[model samples]
Target: MEFDELQDLARGVRQKYAAREHENYGRTWSREEIMLGFLGDVGDLAKLVQGKEGVRPREDLDEAFAHELADCLWSVMTLADSYGVDLEEAFVSTMTELNGVLDET
Candidate 1:
């Protein structure tokens, strides 16, 4: 999907969970939880690397990578929701600058 489509999709997903947050009237995930999720996904990526060296099929490796990435993205999305950050805007702005730097290099 396009960037706008993806952003809309994320908004819908967040809305679903945000409603639950409202139902319970409890806080969303904390910063620590988001950070832990990030670190855990990184560890999972490393494990996939090790597993890749084993006799596992390529499909297994791809599946593992996809799931870990999705988990990491969930944490990021949840974090953005809690903090009121616009994830798509941040991504575009940061990547624009990063791309400039890469071009300079």
Candidate 2:
């Protein structure tokens, strides 16, 4: 799927999670909470990467890695939405800047 399509899907899932969070905890997660969750997901992805690289012992590394990546993506999209940031543009701009830096070396 394209970037926009993926972002839309992420938003839909985030909305459902918001509803679930409200029903269970009386409120949806705050941005800081979302960032914390993203950190946790990043930790999980790190372990999965280690496993994939034969440095850690984890079962189902491939599937878990994919899920963790999706989880991270969801958190990023949700955070960007919360802050009214244009994530796609930011990503492209950041990448372009990084590439320029690399080319100057």
Candidate 3:
């Protein structure tokens, strides 16, 4: 799917989570709190990468690795949405800049 479609899906998932949080905890997560959650997911993703590379011994490695990657992607998309970032534009611009710098080196 396109990035915009993925972003929409991420928003829907965020809404579901927000509703669940409100129901259970009486409040939804703040943007900063969501960013912290994203960081936690990043940590999990790192460990999964290690496991996938055989650098770590984790049970249920393959499935857990894939799930962690998806979690990280969701967190990124959600964060970008929360911040009103145009990820596609940002990604392309950033890559272009990086490639320009690399070419000069």
Tens-digit per-residue lDDT, 1-105, candidate 2: 898898899899989999999999999999999999999999988988898999996777888889999898899999998999999999999999999999999
Candidate 2 segments exceeding 4 Å error: none
Give the 10-residue window scoring lowest on summed lDDT in candidate 1. 51-60
CA-lDDT, candidates in order:
0.74, 0.92, 0.91
How does residue 2 of candidate 3 score in lDDT? 87
Residue pairs that clash (backbone atoms under 3 angstroms), model 2: none
TM-scores of all candidate predictions against the true structure: 0.63, 0.92, 0.91
Candidate 3's displacement at residue 34, Å, is 0.7
| Model 3, C-alpha of 19: deviation from truth (Å) | 0.6
Residue-level error in angstroms, candidate 1, position 72: 0.9
lDDT tens readout by residue for model 3, 1-105: 988898889999999999999999999999999999989998988888888888997789988988888998898888888899988899999999999999999
Residue 97 displacement (Å), model 2 = 1.2
Model 1, stretches more than 4 Å misplaced? 2-29, 53-59
Rate residue 57 of model 2 by lDDT: 69
